[model samples]
Target: MASIQLQGKIFIIGEIEAMTGLHIGGSAGELDIGGVDKPVIRNPLTREPYIPGSSLRGKMRSLLDRHLNKPLRRDRPQVRVHECNRLADYKECSVCQVFGIAPSRNMEDTMPTRLIVRDALLTAETRERFNEIDTDMLYTEVKTEVVIDRITSAATPRQNERVPAEATFGPLEMVHSLYTLDTGSEGSVDSEIALFDTVLMGMELIEDDYLGGSGSRGSGKIAFRKLKVIFKSRKHYENPQSVPIATLAEGDGVSALRKADYQSQISAAMQA
Candidate 1:
């Protein structure tokens, strides 16, 4: 196995706007505020609702896991999702490469997890607005969802707290790194560009798919808006003289980004 080489880091900056309500479950017993059964996770200090990085990353990985339809491993029964345990499988699996997997006995089989998702918090403007306005809770709202009990077949009322629709969580940043790994090369595709595209695909999938809990019954519809991608080469960090490269389309939103085919632009920029 060849030693891994640092290629660069890509930053995906954007705003996650809730097209519909979003409910990422929080600790129920933590607080008895509002009497709502389900509450969205919040910052312990501020008590203002925010999206967890785990929830955001997990949802994207899960969507890709299903989209790729990779065969789930039998050995690790505890891990419910499909994981590429071997060197050969890890090289072939995009979900494992991008989202990553736990290292096995063969150290070369796995590399560092390329993606890092930051906890999304409400934008300054939005937070200000929320602070001023009257809400069921601080910066969040309580919604009642009536569900049916399977055995009893009775309508059960559930009060779920949510970040209301049209609310924006901004300065959303996702960092994806580019590393030349020695898992053994399979193709000529640039590692940086491929992983970048995989991350974009995850974001796209998440846009179509609901996030958080109660997605099927309507809760977590979200949109990535004002998206931009920036690249910082290995030299940029070591040397102050190096300038970060900005690779972005003409317009805002994910649709525009897809239309621009960011992979091609990023590839070009990386080489230049």
Candidate 2:
């Protein structure tokens, strides 16, 4: 058995705050109401709008895939992680390396997925604010939109329920792992840092893009706030006294995301 050098894991935690009214559609079908064709997804227990981890993670993977320009194999338009090894080969693709690859039929050789995203719930602060508002009004706001026919000038109306702008949801958390193996290779540290950088870049890409649904129609603009990544190792877990890798800077807003220095700080922390 080949020995594996256990590199530390990074936990990126923060708030995803809505910059514009955000609508992540729920399972609710066509309903009889003021043209409310779609409604925001909610927690069954709290009945409050929440961002599912799958929604955020899927968007990140898609954006990264687009940025990487890695399209599906001509023969295989869709491939599972297991199938990834045989068809639509992306064995070396960084996006796949981080996000995941479908398990191969054998499944013995597949690497574990490095990224973990948890469902983003309303922040405690936001929950408190909801208490001040009428419980009946706590449900998201619904916006009615019209689809106009360009030729006949006919109008069709549809409504979408959305989490209002300025509302915050989180401490959304993601874990990215780094592993060094026995295979002949270049510096693992640099490789790990590079992978982490890609994760950051993915978040940056999404900001220019959007979150949730109907982004093109001007919904789902969001920003990560107080975004910080903490590094932990097996030793730290065992001893509980060992200091973790230096803490990352808080992601203030979209502006902070745009700064080149933000990327540099990550590299510096890793090297330190």
Candidate 3:
């Protein structure tokens, strides 16, 4: 076994507020639905709408893959993980370096993933006051949608559940570990900045791409706000410094949140 040194760790924490009705569909088992076909996922214990980290991470990876024009494997059902062995000489593959590759080819090669995205839960403040604002304890708003038959000009109505626009969910956390290679460079990608860039790129892409489902019909629009990046070192993990990053808030809405200086803030965190 080879020795791998721990370099540093960066933590990004923020809130995700729904701009429009957001619907990340959950299984509609045998539950009777009067007219609803799809339903948003809820925490089994609280029955509150929560965003799964897997959904966010997967969407970001796919978006980055498309943006970079990286060749994707057609054999797999989900997005393909890039191989560090496949790229050209001396070139760092951003996606693979950040997200990492699982062991394959008889478990011969493996790249440990660096990024960790935790499930986002509704903030306590919002959860408590949701009923005051929306008059629903479930924290979800029901949207009635109509599908018009183009040829017959007939309208068929269906009900969809969504997290209402302007609703906030939070403490969304993303932790990225930095490693120093044996050759003294920061992992195969050579710089932590590259990894941060990849993360921000995916985040920005999601703002345009939309999350969950029914994006074309204007569902799942969201924005990240109050982003704070913190750095921790093994020697002084107890006393970590918060990186002075700019807030994503530009105005009172989602559009303002999208124009955040994510990269610049990350750069400051890296230096700190």
Per-residue alpha-carbon lDDT of model 2 for 1-272, expressed as tens digits? 55566556778888998999899988765333434678777787877788898888888887887787775443356652221454235456778778876554443444568888899998888788767775323546877789999999998988778888888999789888877666425366457556766677788878889998889999988888887767765456556555456565456763563444533454454444
RMSD per model, one decimal: 3.1, 4.2, 4.7
Q: Write the residue-wise lDDT of candidate 1 on 132-154 in tens digits.
A: 88988888888887888899999
Worst 10 residues of 1 by lDDT: 182-191
Comparing 1 and 2 on lDDT, the stronger one: 1
lDDT of 3 by residue, 1-272 (tens): 44566555667778888888889987777334433567788888877789999999988988887788777664478646544455341145778767776555323323357899999988887777776774432687777789999999899988787888887878888887766555344334246544665776787788777889889998988888777666554433534444333332234333444455644554444456
Candidates in order, TM-scores: namely 0.87, 0.81, 0.78
- Alpha-carbon error at 242 in model 1, in Å? 4.3
State the C-alpha lDDT per candidate: 0.79, 0.72, 0.69
- What would you estimate as the lDDT of candidate 3? 0.69
- Candidate 1 runs further than 4 Å off: 73-79, 104-107, 148-154, 182-189, 261-264
Q: Report clashes for each candidate as comma-separated counts.
A: 0, 7, 0
Clashing pairs in 1: none
